[model samples]
Target: METMHKGSAGLVSAPSLREQARKVIRGLVITGQMQPDQLYSVPRLAAELGVSATPVREALLDLEREGLLEAERNRGFRVVSLSLNELNDIFAVRLLLEVPSVGDIAQGGLSDRQLDELHQLAEATRQTADTGNLIAFLDTDLKFHVQLIATLGNQYLAKLVETLRDRVRLQGFASGESPRDFLKQSANEHFKLLDYIAKQDRSGAEATIRRHLERSRGVWGSRHNTTQAAKASVLDESS
Candidate 1:
C-alpha cells in the first residue's frame, strides 16, 4: 500500500518524477479507484496529486504503453476494459507458465521450510477471505502463487507470471462480483494446490492449477455476462 508522494518535501533524490507518478496512477488503476472506460483529465489528476501536468501526462503515457490505459485524440486517457476473450487469453498464458513450471517444482520437491511458508501464506489468504478482505485476499493469493513459481529460480519466467497476474487482477476488479463466495472458493483451491505440491503429486498439481484457473475464468465470465445482459435490457427498454 505504499505510494510515491507528489509533494513530499522531506524526501531526497527524486531522480524520475514520471516514474513516481506512474506508480501512483498504476496504484489507482489496480485498486479499482479508477474505473475502466472512464476518461480522466490530466490537469485534474495532476492537481489532485499536487504536481504539475507534465509528470502526470508522462506517467499516463507509460500506463498506456503498459496496456492499462488508452489515450484519446486531444483528450485525456481511458482505463482499458478487458473483454472475455482477452481474459481467456491471459489465462492461456498463465497455464502455459504455471502448469508446467509448478508441476516441475512439485516433482523436483520442496524443502520443509518452503512448504511451511507456503502453508502459512495459504492460511493467511483464507483468513482474509473469511473477513471479506478482497484486496488483502487478492494480494496474499498472488504472493502465494508467485512464490510457488519462484521456486523454479527463473526470474524472467516469474516476472512473466507476475505480469499475467496483474492483467488478471484488472479483470477481477472489473468483474464487480461479491467477494465473499468467490474469494472463499479461491482460498480453498489454494490449499488444495499446496497439498498437491507438498505430496510431490505433479499430475495433481497440474490438474489443480487448471481447475483453479477455470474457476477464476468462470467467475469473471459470469460478471461480464451479467453486465451485458443489464445493458441489453436497458437498450430494449429505451427502444
Candidate 2:
C-alpha cells in the first residue's frame, strides 16, 4: 500500500521504497520513540509505516547487517545500543570512508548541473537553520553530502556512505542536540564542504569532512556525558 505524504511522492516497490522505509525506522530509533534494545516487531513497524511486513523485515535485516541491531534470544530483533567505544568506532570508520570519498568527489569534477543542485541544497539548509528547523536542516545537509558522493558514480561506495549515515542518524543527530549553535555549526560545515568541492580542491574537501566528522563525534560525546550525569543525579535522588 502506497500513501503519499504531502509534498512527497508516492512510494512504489522500488529502490525508493527501501530508502523511505529506512528513513522511517531510523527516525523512530533516533527520536527515542523506539528505545535501544527494544524488540522490533516487523508487522507493527509495517503498520506504522503504512507498508507491508516484507519491506519492514527487509529494512530491519539490512539495518541489522549494518550493525544497528542484534539477534536476540527470545525477543525477535534488538536495537543495538551505542556505547562510548562503539560511537568512537563509528567515527573512525566515517573518517576512512567519507573523508576520502569527498576528496574523490572533488577530483572527479561534478557536472555543472550537479554543482547547481548542491548549491540549492545548501540554500535549503541555510533556510532551515535560519528558521530554527534543525531537523529539516540536517536532512538537507545529509542530502547534500549523500547526493554529492552518490553522483560520483560508484554504487558500492554510495551504499557504504548511506549505511554509515544511518548509524549517525540513529544517534539522535537528526534532532539537533546541545544548543542552536551546534545546528548552525553543522550547517556551516556543509557550506564549507560545498565551497571546497566547487573549487575542485580535493585536499580541502577531504580535510573539511574529516574535521566535520571529528566535531560530530565530540558533540555526541558531550551530549552523552550530559545525559549520563543527569541520569546519575536522578538515581541519587531516588536512592
- Estimate candidate 2's alpha-carbon lDDT, on a 0 to 1 scale: 0.70
Candidate 2 versus the native: TM-score?
0.73
Compose the digit string of candidate 2's lDDT tens values, residues 1-239.
Answer: 12212222223566666677766665555544455535767665666666777777777777778877776654466666677777778778888888878998888778889889988987887777777654466678778778877876887877777677767645453233425676677778788988898888999999888888888788777756665676789999999
Candidate 1 to truth, TM: 0.77
Ten contiguous residues minimizing lDDT sum, candidate 1: 3-12
Q: Score residue 235 of candidate 2 by CA lDDT.
A: 93
Per-residue accuracy of model 1 over 1-239 as CA lDDT, tens digit each: 22323332111237887887786676567656566646788887877677778888999998898788889978888777877788788988888888889789889999999989988999989998999766567778888988888888998888788777767656445434446888898899888988898899999999999888888877666766765687789999999
Per-candidate clashes come to 0, 0
The C-alpha TM-scores of every prediction are 0.77, 0.73
Query: Which pairs of residues have clashing backbones in candidate 2?
Result: none
Best-fitting candidate, scored by TM-score: 1
